[model samples]
Target: MDDLVRIHDILQHATPESLVILNEIFTSTTLADAIDLGGKILGRITAMGLVCVCVTFVDELASLNQATVSMVSTVDENDPAKRTFKVIRKPADGLAYAMVLARKYRLTHDQLKERIIP
Candidate 1:
């Protein structure tokens, strides 16, 4: 059985706890598998009224419930390559895609202006 499945089984049978911390439980799974497992685990956690801190790349998890809050690591506006290492609680707005594209294609404001004017 997969490690995530085993962990889920364990969590299901364990006594109700106050806090649960899960770190990247979906790391080794495909997108579909990750969503399935994540949803199940989150559902169980919510049913038990347990406080959970789940680290995930799946942004959909943030909207799963009112109790679920999201915080994202941010980068500096002045330096796209520099990570501020600060986590701010907010809804996911798909801004990370813009940042990735900017870095990958050198699409920063200054770079764009230089290319367009020449």
Candidate 2:
């Protein structure tokens, strides 16, 4: 996502979904701790070899209703790798946060760092 043009286009067309995205990303066990210890959950995911990383872009979710967004890398059962999701506090457009925990997975520190890098 380093390409500004692509990033801009994503921002333009991106519409965040409701917080349910978070539910789909992490299991009920992990979801219980997502909001309280978001950092820890993220760390655990990375330790598990997943790529649920945080991003720092202009978030439109906030504009919808003081909502906050968190980026994640969830595992896809149907696929071999993980998928990214934008976790939002409130529901908005048709887009929902990416579910990185849809499947079992983990990510190393280097991989986590790469995803966080701007």
Candidate 3:
């Protein structure tokens, strides 16, 4: 995969002073695969002592190791569709990707059945 190739490059060349930023990666794969592979990449980055900023939808990634510091975007409780746009520095929890994203995008069960296009 393209991501794997890029990751290989990073692992081979990145130094401690480097700042690595990764967006949602391995998205074409399953949740378990995404977490497993992404977590390994994070592990390598931490081992190299690189100052990395990894933004991911995987909640489990929030607590990979001691070097990882997670920040999560919050949604309004009263209006779940409204993003507070406030990021809190904490480990993400109870966000099982599928259900969380469905709710976040306002794709309720009824709404999904009514949709024609993504």
Candidate 4:
């Protein structure tokens, strides 16, 4: 499809000095196919030592921990209406964003339990 063609075009002329930026690629395909194909393309780019900034909802891709890969996400501490994006040099925590934020605000289940018991 168009997505594939666009990606192919980008890859065809990509070089190590390239700074590729992609957003939700292969969305026209199934989730699994998108992840698989996208991962392969990204892997190829990574192998070429290209600097890429890809925005995707696929956790598999976001969790990529290669030496050439650095993951960053927008974080809104406890407010959902605003985007207080903090630039982090690592992957997001394994816990859900809400849960992590709750912990930050001392609002986690464990924190509540301690308050109730003590």
At residue 86, what lDDT does model 2 achieve?
30
lDDT per residue, candidate 4, 1-118, as tens digits?
8888898899899887889999989878898998798888888888888888987767677765463455666556565434466656776454346765687678988999999998
Q: Order candidates by TM-score, high to low.
A: 3, 1, 4, 2
Error of 2 at 102 (Å): 34
Cα lDDT, model 1, residue 106: 86
- Per model, how many backbone clashes are there? 0, 16, 0, 0
TM-score: which is higher, 1 or 4?
Answer: 1
Query: What's the lDDT for all of these models?
Result: 0.78, 0.35, 0.83, 0.76
Off by over 4 Å in 1: 9-17, 95-118
Instruction: Show where candidate 3 strays beyond 4 Å.
Output: 96-109, 112-118
Report the C-alpha lDDT of model 3 over 40-73, residue by residue, as the tens digit: 9998888888998888888878899888898988
For candidate 1, lDDT tens digit of each residue in 1-118? 4757767776767666557888878778788888787888888888888888887778777678877888887888877566788999988655565666686788989889999998
TM-score of each: 0.69, 0.18, 0.79, 0.67
- Residue pairs in steric clash, candidate 4? none
Best by TM-score: 3
Q: After superposition, how far is residue 50 of candidate 1 from its true place, in Å?
A: 0.8
